[model samples]
Target: MSRVATRPVTLPNGLQLQTGERCVADLGRMVDPTVYKNPEQFDGYRFVRMRGTPGLDAQAHLVSTSPEHIGFGHGKHACPGRFFAGNELKIALAHIIMKYDWQLTPGYKHRWEEYGFGWSSDGMAKLLMKRRDSPEMDIDNF
Candidate 1:
């Protein structure tokens, strides 16, 4: 996970853009509703409606939000290790949640670092966790 940069660098137009970013694309921004019925909701099942349909190759597919899912980054610079990292993170977090009773302090603080155009966890608020005997909290919940 990344955090928004706190420092401000000058822009060509002298306008300040927030350093943090978010996904800005959706069906309305690309596909037409005459084709996509109700195009606004994030329906995980939306793809189910187009199962066996054909005739869509590269250019047509380019208009889709499917394969280019940016959660894995984009283009040649995209992470090459994402698949491994994803599984590892999932396994690790699952193990921790299943084996420990962890809670944030009522008033907690965090630190971060920024370099180049990126920011990362500062290692502060490392975590407060301990093993739990009860099996009530399932790792699957994580």
Candidate 2:
């Protein structure tokens, strides 16, 4: 006789049915279908200025975060290292944007290789950047 094994499902509040790795919640189900219509389009600001559903926490400021966006992982078992990672990413991006003009070099091509389900761009790729001469780009009467 052959033995059959089955995996147990996890509940929302961190109740594990069967012992295993951290819960793998389906992050996609929590997204609002209306705002994320045709989610494959990849609109970066899709969740900006969104309001919480009526009767939910009236003060819930969910502007930047949505269940649809899994950049920071999800649920109770979410990445414990995310707080540090978030701050680091923001600081690095701010420094880069404030210090230099970032753009892809002309005629440069980006090649990628797939690892697991994700792909990563290969090589240094040679970004072209230049320092800004003006202190303020938008303000003229400074």
Candidate 3:
């Protein structure tokens, strides 16, 4: 969602310019072959490897989006509550996985909405989930 504009100037190739709005996309960097190996694949451990890499900052985790991965945006414009949001999401996911049996609806296929800038999932995917326990469940087990 970053907004940028170029300075009014002339180019060496004899192109004229006027100051106007421009789009600065970080999505390209997220899947750049030069920055990430097997960029097309959805590897959850991608950032884990990056964190373990020698000479890299250990504190810079997957949730800490940067120019390389702008899921939460970058720099000063990044999500201010990302850390809290990430932790809450992790806790909720852990609870669901530990206490439920879940699966996607049979023959279900994901559909994404395409746009000029990017794409997003249709958000109508179906899932079947049930509680693992018949009686009272113990939170301590989780």
Candidate 4:
């Protein structure tokens, strides 16, 4: 999120925020290796594992948000539709995985490039997908 500083302020870490300057928060920085192990790599069950930890059960849920997990934002600014969005994504992914096989296009390599608060993958990146012969579960019942 971007905010314009109303007055100069010095952060606890000593970073200066100048008046009228636009400051953008990089959400990705919040989940850095300092906060997560092997953060640079993808792990589908990462949160599932975190949820199993004693104190993290509720905090690790898909729609749960805190200062550490801000996907749906935190506090009063949190998205009201986060719960609906999370369930929709799960249903969509379940159907997609049941009906099709998909993978990155052969020999395609892409990395996220960041410019200010914007990040993008290779513009030409593509995915290869094909219908599956049999779905593990009936998606129609969903």
Winning candidate number (TM-score): 4
TM-score of each: 0.38, 0.49, 0.68, 0.77
Q: On a 0 to 1 TM-score scale, where does candidate 4 land against the true structure?
A: 0.77
Badly placed stretches (over 4 Å) of model 3 are 2-24, 56-60, 134-142
Runs of candidate 2 with Cα error greater than 4 angstroms are 1-35, 38-42, 49-67, 109-112, 121-124, 134-142
Q: How accurate is candidate 1 locally (lDDT)?
A: 0.54
lDDT of 2 by residue, 1-142 (tens): 1112246765667765653444344545444565356654556554442344553332223222335555555466456777677777776666667667878889887777764444557667888888777532333333
lDDT of 4 by residue, 15-105 (tens): 9999998876568745578777887667889889988899878787899987777778888988999989999999899999989999998
Q: How many backbone clashes does candidate 4 have?
A: 0
Query: Residue 41, candidate 3: how far off, in angstroms?
Result: 2.0
Error of 1 at 122 (Å): 4.0
Better of 1 and 2 by TM-score: 2
Prediction 1 TM-score vs. true: 0.38
